[model samples]
Target: MADKEATVYVVDLGASMGDCHNGRDESDLDFGMRYVWDKISTTVAASRKTWTLGFVGLNTDETNNTQDEEGLEGYHNISTLQEIGPMTMTELRELHPKVKPCEAYSGDALSAIVVAITMIEEFTKKLKFKRRIILVTNGESPIDDEDDSITDVAEKLNEHNIELVIIGVDFDDPEYGFKEEDKSRAKRQNEETLRKLVEACENGVFGTMQQAVEELSIPRIKPVRPFKAYDGPLTLGDPNKYESAISINVERYFKTKRATPPSATTVVVNPDRGYTQSQAFDDGDVEMGGTEFSNVKHMRKYKVNDPSAPGGKLDVPYEELAKGYLYGRTVVPFSDSDMAITKYETTKSFTIIGFIPFDSYSPFLNMGETGLIAAKKFDEKSEIGLSALIHALHELESYAVARYVQKDGAQVQILLLKPNPGIEDEYECLYDVPLPFAEDVRSYQFPPLDKVLTVSGNVLKEHRLLPNQDLKEAMSDFVDAMDLSGFDVDEDGNPVDYAPIDEVYNPVIHRLNQAIRTRAVHPDGEIGPPPEILLRFSKPPEKLIKKARPDIEALIDAAELKKVPEKAKGRFKEAVKPLSGLDIDAILGQKKRTVISPENAIPEFKQALATAEDDETVEKAVKQMGEIIRKLITNSFADVFYPRAAENLRVLREELIGLDLPLLYNKFLRALKKSLLSGELNGDRREMWFKYIIGGQLGLVTKEESEMSDVTEEDAKAFVKK
Candidate 1:
């Protein structure tokens, strides 16, 4: 058995932002790359147990620094654009390691595959076992050329059985340049290419960085020890005194590997029924299972009767007796059995003798051989039958040992072979014992038999099988230690429940926030005003909302209604403010002759709609005109305050939907409640009332709020006052 278990090699190709965008880091772009890299690296490092890591950089393919002095050739960088290098575990540790700000070289796709595959092959050759390669990339093949394809490279990799994973990082492009038409198209194309690459390679892919990290993880492994072996009874006359040597010629009777059909010939034994089951007879009387399960001893019957010669003594040979029972048995000499064998004529046989096993001897044998000859009882111990009896005993012991070893799950062979040249020709055995205990003679003992045995090739008949359990455990331990869970990539990549959801959810919200903030800062740059407002104004909201109404009532109404007043108020005042103190009463109000002018019945309404030629009644003239006019004027004032009412509603709807809230009405109710609680408010503050209260957390505003508090209280107050 071996001391340590096998090894697995882990090559972590650390993350990189490809060299596509001129290596200039955009804030959103850099943030995304770092987020993905951190997730992937941390995940891979945590998962493996039996594996050791060998790190390599994929995009940064630097030149070879040393010459190959050991006649082992090295691979050249497949592309001139990437300056990549091979860093050992130590070399990587020495450097301040971080995912370098590298650009996606649209030509290094094949080079990346070549370097990765070659590195794994070379690294694992010394270890000499099954090797697995896990490559984590964003599925972006940097090679944009039409002439060369990475598909061919993937096929070559399939031959080596390296598992490739293309983790699609920044799957939802958070940057803002693409037009609305391109968003779905670009995303689809990127996803499709990613799918193709992963399919072309040997293994499947994990789409997001989160999944990639989870998939590349592993756990710890434990060690196991092997077992001990047992020995059986010895033949006293065996050549090695108390030893019994059985030579199993596995080639003649046993197969090297398990049989193709696995025990096609059946041999079964039921002790209660008193005989082995044979395949020739389908009945329970004959059983044939594995050689280990055979009860051949109980199945054999040697007839000693000489039918042709009536009342005459018959001669039987011990060699024929032994040969008839065991095909390839080897034996060695033992103590008193040698003398008994020389004195007794083993060739003698009797007339009219019947055959039965020694274990089932008739009552006559107990009364001595005289009872069987004088009382006309069964004949059993003919000279030839004794050899057959010995052969049966050998087979029984051999089968027991073979069955034991097989039950423990080890590989064992039952060899039936000729004995080695030695002192005398008799029966003995030299079966394989457990590794260390084979030499420990005292721990393993057997009962002595008076029969003689031989260690010579001629006297050696055949050796049978017995059980061995020690080897089985060793094989089982090997398989358990080599468990493939260590090979799973996702083991380490799983996210902890304790990890902050903001870190998980915010980059998405942050990108959306970025897109929203950009439009807020430069409305004309990308996100134009809402379709409703964009159609109304050629200029932006910043330029449009600057002017305000001079009417106190109108301004208060606008604030209460949460809306912007008409810009028409500013335009009209600009055009006509120079004349009549901007008095609209003289410009458009009706004339009256009553003590209280009719205009008093609806003061602001009169001015707002003075051009109305329709014969509408001024009923407040007959009632209390002053109070009625004021009410009418207040209602008109509200109309002037809320100008971009439609636009505000649209923008509010988008924000609420972006937040994934239940509905627009719910968001509006929330914003309304918030604004009512906080008296201090501005137009933008009102927008935020809708932005956060209605839109839920409004994503990643925590950083912005932190910066807000950093400004001095006085400055904040002053800024607020402004």
Candidate 2:
């Protein structure tokens, strides 16, 4: 199988396809394009230049195919939506809106296949590229097969080893259990024609449109070659000094790695291109202006706050700035020339420092990814030496702790290598996991749950805090009933495990990929809910939970666990009642107002804290001010109350800074930022953050602004972007 591929996707877009069929709400064209979009999006995601893709719109309103350009008698109503080349996000955007139903009612499906074949042929040019042509249609359009065109096309496809896939909408398929009751005569004839063509071709697939569309949800795993991370020696002990010490050349390769989803980037879209010329411009369609977008670039510059400057900030060039390390509220500056002295430079090496009993090495201590340390391939001497070392370690039931530096200037790591003995044909190897350094490890001690220590330091097992036998038994029963193992059944009705390791996929990665592809294909269509399998294990099975209700109820009663009343959702505010009924203000001989009226919030907030003598009074006043800001943001229209809210935040920040309580101000700002970003207030109020918090210079307080603050200058400057 070739890694590089040249695929041409032919989508039928005739007039009849525009009308919904077979009781389906969506048109035939829309239904068929779902499969096309999935395939195209997959190629785009691969991001390989060699794996090129071209899209041809069959029965389109225009004719712009390669065959038509060569003065062909047929191949009319065929337009090339995308050229035969590497697929990019730009190409995907351009091709998306173009794959729609055309006004042209009839076209030659055979002619479309010929056009696709010509595209792949011209692009691949007898190269070793895996060529493919996918045809998705309702088969309603007339395909002119009046001559050797069909035979000639099938022969060409076979000669090039091109894989042809034909999918027909509302077509009968006994294997798929799908048969249309009232299929059109023209469509049936075209379907048979396609089936015969597929039969003539060496590599071809003929299936119903429903069958192809149903399989689109299955994820396609990308093929990858195992890359050697480190090719060096796996040394044990000091081989130079001790003759009995082990030294064998080895190679390290990743056994497993966590897969991450494609990241989103911010770009500037040009509306002048094909977008926003009219009164009704869709903001969601960034490509409404013809899919033109410019990559966003970031520029960095250091600035120092200066009251004397016009903007209250003085810009400093990069050349003048010196790197500084924070040291106990002080910046220890270092110039570029002096930076080398601060670095701990070392050469590449992998040496076993010591050995420890396997029992002493806790698996929980493993911090990073695991990889394989195998003897250098095809080196008999190294292989034999490594095999002997592995056998010794396996016999001793021990693990070797090694210091491994992959390459010069690479990260130095502490690795725990466990030996694995091999059978007759299998090669012996060592499985290694990165270990944490002494400074990275943290230890905590807590009182035992089975017993409690009293004020006199005497342990008691039957105390109120300890769990009773009934509670323990009930909890055990509840846990057992909720277990997922054996929840699914096999072919013989045997209880099998649910969500096996290979079957379970990371929902976040696949869900996001699915969303991106869906939006690219159908920008206006409501995204289908996440696949059922992805969310199957998210919660306990309903049946199991229902069956264990008694145990759950008994456990809850035995433990006396009651739902704690939530405190107004943490940062969101509401009126608070003092349970003691003792007015602190009255006791201090000044009855401060408990609330800041939304209308006169600023002055009332100042008044509420004017007579404050303790942290509690100041905190209450700040909370009142915060509540007013939140209310203004929520209740007002658009940015009508934004300036007012910003003003409230400004006042609170200044007061906290002046009062030497930066922690209080920083905590509130973080919560406010989170709320604004998550659209909790209304539809992502990031504009408020950009305009007021960052632009108005009301970010986290740096140590320069407040002596008690721990925030560095760089952190304060970057907080707004985050």
Deviating ranges (above 4 Å) for candidate 1: 1-53, 61-89, 95-98, 123-128, 139-141, 145-148, 171-191, 204-206, 214-722
Residue-by-residue lDDT tens digits, candidate 2, 1-722 = 44788898888888988989878999988888878878888777777778888888888888998778888887788888888988766657666677777799667888888888888888888778888999888888788655476788899899889999998888899999999987778778878888889999999999998988888776665565776899988777777899987789999998777688999868786655664333223443333324555556679988999999879999999999998999999999989889887788877999999999988978899898888889898999998998888899999999988999999988899999988888654767898999998999899999888899899999898977778898889889888877777667899989998777877767889888999888765677788988877787788778878887888888899888767545542222343446656876668896657777878988888776665667898898888887888777777687788888898999998877777888888988888888888888867687888887788888998999988899999998788666
Q: In candidate 2, how many Å is residue 611 off?
A: 24
Candidate 2 lDDT for residue 499? 71
User: Residue 130 of model 1: what lDDT?
Assistant: 41
Model 1 lDDT per residue over 423-525, tens place:
2554332222112123332455663332224556233223223212333344454444434333223457753432222222223322333344343323355
**Candidate 2 segments whose C-alpha is farther than 4 A from its true place:** 61-76, 103-106, 143-155, 174-176, 184-193, 196-202, 239-243, 269-317, 325-331, 336-338, 422-428, 521-528, 563-722
**For candidate 2, what is the TM-score?**
0.72
CA displacement after TM-score superposition, residue 638 of candidate 1 (Å): 99
lDDT for residue 400 in candidate 2, whole number 0-100: 88
The deviation in Å at residue 41 for candidate 1 is 9.4
